[model samples]
Target: MVLIDRIRLCLEKLLEVFTVFLLIALTTIVLAAVGFRLLGASLHWYDEVASIGLGWLTFYGANLAAIKRAHMGFPGLVGSAPVALRASLFVISEIIVIGFFVVIAYYGYLVLDILAWDRLVSLPSISLTVTQSAIPISAVLFILCELLSMPGAWAKMRHGIDSEHEAIEEAIRMAEQDLQESRS
Candidate 1:
């Protein structure tokens, strides 16, 4: 559990940094595009690249969400299940979630082949494969994040803890602690 926690933390940090960079880059590109257009010229690659960046950001952001367990879930429903069925529900849900991603990654890879000779329409120098690789890459990252977070999630499930509520309480506790420290 400790090892998993450490690995998850590391993955979370890396994703945070990468996503931030992607956001900044996309912002800069969009701003440049707008400024250039206002000046009577426009970047041909601006729209395509920005769209690709947005897609990448969404995929990677999703991986971070998975690591933090921030995605939508039915904890209330699962928690309400009879104790005898909770374990089964847990297993079934995990199988379904992981399996869905596996299928996505598989097809995302196949799409790369179909686009093997394709390049960005606006920027012929850049291959579509490079931009589209985010699909499979992020899918795999999400699976990794899910596995890393599963132990803690299982423990919480066993104890009937709602992670969303716990997260809110933790935030309030942290704010109070910060206020106390300032007074001291």
Candidate 2:
């Protein structure tokens, strides 16, 4: 359990750093393209590349949100249920989420296969498959985060902890402890 926690923490930190850098690069790319256009110049690759980067950012951000359990969900019904019912509902919900990702990853590969020989319209040098690979990759990353989160949920359920509030507070406390340690 501790090992899984560490792995999840490590992935979260890495994703945070990656997201920051990705955003910086995206901003620079867009601003540079805009500035050049103001000077009667244009970057032909700007549209396609920026669009690709945005897609990647969105997918990666989804995975990050999943790990944090920050996505919008209406769990009011589950919250009012008995402990066993709540656990069962939670597990069923998780299985559904997992199933969704699995389907995405599976069909995403088939889509990639069909586009393997196709190139981007604006960037002939780049393959369509390369840009579209974000779907499957994001699916895999989301699956990993979900898998890591489940055991903790199981533990919390076993301990009769309030899933909505207590786990969130526990996560925040751990983050603060990590932050304090880094500062010290």
Candidate 3:
């Protein structure tokens, strides 16, 4: 368990760094492209490169969001539910999430297999698989994050405690109280 946690921490840090790098790279490419275009020296490959970078950013960003439990969702219903029911619902929701990612990743692998020989339209040097691989790669990363978080989720569910959600809720409650006090 210690080793698994160490690995998870390492993976999280690595992904965080890579995500930042991708964001920086994407921003640089985009800004440079825009500047070049303004100077009347447009780069033909800008759109293609930008689109691919955006796709990668979306995937990795989403993976990070999941890891952080920052993905948007209406959790009010679950939050209001009875403890046992909430835990059950959480488990069910997790199952659905995991199953969906697994299926998509499997199909993504198939897509990669088919597109292995294909190259990008603008960047002929790069294989389509390389660009399109963001899908399966992100899916796998998400799965790993999910699995790593399972114990915490289960403990929270069983104990009727979730520090992450509770912290947010506490903050909101405090803000509401402050607003009320100020109005009074």
* TM-score per candidate: 0.92, 0.83, 0.84
Which window of ten consecutive residues has the lowest lDDT sum in model 1?
78-87
For candidate 3, write residues 45-144 as lDDT tens digits: 9999999999999999888777766676546666667887888898888999999999989999999999999998887999999999999999998998
lDDT of 1 by residue, 7-104 (tens): 99999999999999999999999999999999999898898999999999999999989998889988888887877687788888889989999999
lDDT agreement with native, every candidate: 0.91, 0.85, 0.85
lDDT per residue as tens, model 2, 1-184: 7899999999989878877887888999999999999999999899989998998888988888888776776555566678888888888989999999999999998899999999988889989999999999889899998898778766765556665676588899999999999999
Query: Which parts of model 2 have CA positions greater than 4 angstroms off?
Result: 157-184
**lDDT value for model 1:** 0.91
What TM-score, to 2 decimals, does candidate 1 have? 0.92
Cα error, candidate 3, residue 29 (Å): 0.4
lDDT of 1 at 142: 85
* Comparison by TM-score, 2 against 3, better one: 3
Q: Which residue runs does candidate 1 get wrong by more than 4 Å? A: 178-184
Error of 2 at 141 (Å): 1.0
Whole-model lDDT for model 3 versus the true structure? Answer: 0.85
